[model samples]
Target: MKALFISLCLSLLMILSSCEGRTGYLDEGQQNTVAMLTDVEWLVVYVDYSISNEQTFDDETNIYSFGRDTKGWTATGSLKDPSIKKDVRYFQWTFTTENYAVIYMAGNSTDGYWMIEKLTPDELWVVITASDPVLYPNQYKTYYKLKARKRQ
Candidate 1:
């Protein structure tokens, strides 16, 4: 009886030790993504619209700040173009449980879901898609891509 109880205790201890650093919710990759996102301000470097074939290369002044509280702000403007007025917009964002690569954003200017194509310490690329001919004129589906780089 003593030997059986000692074996059971050892097994329980091993099981608990295995879960020591586990968050039980977010995996390591997801935690890393969250860390990278809230690390610094990101500057918009490129924008592309699929239906219109419109591409805009930003002057690296359009900034995006993601906070740990899941709130963020975007400062839109061009450093090279004096005619472009600077605009600040606030938004709430969260990753979907079904797919962490997808982010849902709701704000005054941004209201949609965006899929992350690439994410690194210094670069991020995301795409938003809308599929409605009536709403999105020229094409059955419209895709908008935004590329950003971390601000120094």
Candidate 2:
């Protein structure tokens, strides 16, 4: 029994040591991307997916705002759905190599994982692969394109 316990401990130690840690700084290009994304509040100009249709944000009627901070982000807007209430939430964002993910920071249940497709000062594009609860059994590879809101 003692020998078996020792073997188990050794095995656990090996497994733990093999796991990678999330400790790294963004490269120069990645830093630039992050800077641009955080520079201004973004309007959701287009969202195309199996779960949701494409939408354009106008000054009146339809409006969506998404922004990122140093450590977290916030988004608040309406989906133009009568049945669904307006969405407003805060989340923590982490950026990796050409990818980023958001985790709900306020106990809200929305999370997102996206791969960066195009990143520019004026335009930001990302691809999201997910499965919707409403459209279960069907996966969606969605594309979201957003343009920076004009600063007045």
Off by over 4 Å in 1: 1-24, 58-61, 78-85, 130-152
Write down the lDDT of every candidate, Cα atoms only: 0.67, 0.55
Which residue pairs come into collision in candidate 2? none
Q: How many clashes (backbone atoms < 3 Å, residues ≥3 apart in a chain or on different chains) does model 1 have?
A: 0
TM-score of 2: 0.54
TM-score against truth, every candidate: 0.63, 0.54
Q: How well does candidate 2 score on lDDT at residue 98?
A: 41
Model 2 misplaced stretches (Cα beyond 4 Å) = 1-23, 60-70, 77-87, 98-109, 131-139, 150-152
Which numbered prediction scores highest in TM-score against the true structure? 1
How does residue 85 of candidate 2 score in lDDT? 25
Which candidate's lDDT is highest? 1
Clash totals for all candidate models: 0, 0
